[model samples]
Target: MPTKTKSKIKITNKKVVQKKNLKEEVDVRTPDGGGWLYSDIVKDHFFNPRNFMQYGEEEKFKFNGIGRVGSPACGDEMVLWVQIDPKTEKISQCRWRTFGCGSAIASTSALSEMIVENSGMKIDEALKLKPQNILERLGGLPNRKVHCSVLGDKALQSAINDFFRNTAQHSRVQTAGAKVIDKELNVTDHDIEEAVLEGAQNLEDLQHKLKVGVFNKEVIPQLEDLLRFYNEKYYG
Candidate 1:
């Protein structure tokens, strides 16, 4: 008799995940209308934030500048300087010099903190997020500042692209680890790592985890735990 071979199974039409470590109370569609615009974290950081402000010629960071956005055309000039961690492929430092309103200043400031906190996130994932996402976490942003919200997204992307163009080799690894967000499409290595760590049996499990949201440390384990608990409770 001939020995039979086992057929391996595969997952199909898996839901794509975008943006990582999003806020649970995210209201993308309705978005805060006339309530507290930002969260305490934004307020705390915007007030003081991490590290020093106002980079100069003799500053320690000495940003060579990976990317710069805006000009007199947009009524502002934004410049981003990124310092990558040699080993972790993480953003060790993010500094932006922008000339605009408080929204511009506040939004950029909040963005720096987010990048530092979520070092594992990819540039795309980080770019996909709006300043309002940060503003919403704080008490709130003035309506006029809404425009500045997207600036953070654009500026970060420009900086990321600069990182890719200027230094493409290792950045590939960083690009691979971005988070999934609502309405996001691109996938990277970070996604695979997160999914595997989450113990996601299928794409559906990963998508569900994205809906609820994630954080820095428990990026994968949190999803995995949910899957096990959910399966035992529902599928069991």
Candidate 2:
């Protein structure tokens, strides 16, 4: 339950549950002669999962996208939803729903909370999460269970990737719309693009310009030169 604090903590390392017919893929070792779980961080979280994935139907937040990761049969799928404030590029809301062992739940819970606490954390930052860090907070994991705990961070990264992918696809929609608008305005593709590029340049220069107006005498001369040049070549 005290999953919020992961900065530094103690772990009582012990296997809370035994896997039926599971092979020992990894051997737990420490500075001493091949000791297993010299510390006990895993057992604590297993008994009381700090951030087990649970969500209400009526959760509040306006988010840009949602992402889910992991295999269901693996029994560890994490769903993450994030809401961003467009004006400030800040995370207005972040939530995670996870299914797995205590470590999985706590890791997810910790990760989501960390993101919410960070508020403006980018997807890149979220991807850096590791199971060791999560275990360090609770205490430490039974050396063998490290892989199981690592799933939480992996799922979080997958979910973050999904959210960004969706966001990028949504962003591309505007370009499609612009092409349609170009047709409707009776503007050639190249002509509209050139105009847009020029407009952007004008906008960039506006900050430094002493005078601003479409009809400004000095600006009009530059416009005339552009018009004449285009008329003589591209327009003809």
Candidate 3:
């Protein structure tokens, strides 16, 4: 009986497809692609931006503080200008120009409104505004687009820092990620970054410009490392 037993055969065919809502799918490939739904605030700002400086109009405004952040090569650049009220020590006016995605434009527009709308926000208060505040004001940006909002925050901070630096308020200048690389000479990462941005590409030229490691050669290595990083970040 065992020798005569025939082998049992089973055949089954099925196709399984997992379904997902458009928003839930991550990196789904489609002809039309996918993207997040922007908030109404973002849409309004992108379409009708506030306090934006059009090209060739830089001379119109007498800006006391100026700042630039991000690079065109990286696909986002922002330039912010602030007019400080001498008596109030507040930001009298805030304007900006941006070359980037919708998110960047929207974020900057929101920031401009926040700055000048309420009879001008205080300089210290304005400086305290973070990327999250802009994001929240915009209702929300996609996770991937969150970085764009940071450009607005940085540009504002940079403008404030410039105001402080120009006013000889060195103590008030808050430089993010700036470290005192040369403790002896009081050289910081910000100094090296500025030197590189000003076209000092070589270490020798940078030293000549910033005197970063003049007194302490031991700090040269650290300065060089920072230079390389900033060069690649802002220039490359």
Candidate 4:
């Protein structure tokens, strides 16, 4: 009989396996490794935000149009300023301030750069800059962070409306058609819609989330209609 060849078995070192497992655990606890994967461009803009207004430097900016959105109580707010070139109808400068997350900062910063770059975009063209456009420029945001991108475009539109109003172009002022729900808190239908998108399912949920229509019984019917509408529109 042929001599049986000695079989060599390969085994992975236990220490190496333990080290790899530890690395995976650590990764799961970290932001990027925990699945909050932002694009390189988003990180760049978030870390080095552009066109942000320095506190107390607002007076020196010479901006003609100003706009604000979101609520402090709701945990996100943004203010934008624009300087329009009267002769060229182009946005000469764009600046902003936001109390929000990294995505919010990055989105607004990218938007300001977009508006002011290449000799600046015309007001009409700038008005057409949607959240999708900004997301495309930033390589896109996480699904939950998508709402943050809306702050930039909405604030920009408000600033444009301010510019139109300041220039006595009343006819050009565009309204968002947001119906107020709670006068004391200054909540609106838009707020309800956002709450629904954020997982608010019913009137009590809305009340707990937004404090909307709490004391305002008159708007309950309207709020319910809005809640149903949003639930159907978004969930379906």
* Best candidate, lDDT: 4
lDDT of 4 by residue, 1-236 (tens): 66677557766565743222211212112445654456678889999999999988877899888877775555677888999998899999988998888778888889999999999999888888878888778777766777644588888887886687568665565545667666655566766766776689999998886666777788888889999998888776
Best candidate per TM-score, number?
Answer: 3
CA deviation > 4 Å runs, candidate 3: 1-36, 181-191, 198-229, 232-236
Q: Any residue pairs clashing in model 3, and if so which?
A: none
1 versus 2: better lDDT goes to: 1
**Worst 10 contiguous positions by lDDT, candidate 3:** 20-29
Q: Is candidate 2 or candidate 3 better by lDDT?
A: 3
- What's the lDDT for all of these models? 0.52, 0.48, 0.76, 0.77
User: For model 3, what is the C-alpha lDDT against the true structure?
Assistant: 0.76
* TM-score ranking, best first: 3, 4, 1, 2
TM-score of each: 0.47, 0.45, 0.70, 0.62
Angstrom error at residue 73, model 2: 1.6
Q: Model 2 Cα RMSD, Å?
A: 19.2
| Model 2 TM-score, all chains together | 0.45
Clashing pairs in 4: none
lDDT string for model 3 (1-236, tens) is 56766578655575756442222322323456453367667889999999998788788888888877776767888889999886798888878989899888898999999989878999888888888788778777766777654588788887887776567665676756667676554456766675676677878998776555766788877777887888887767
List, residue by residue over 7-82, the lDDT tens digit for candidate 1.
4776588887644334344322234565334544544555664543464633667442254545434576556677
**TM-score of structure candidate 3:** 0.70
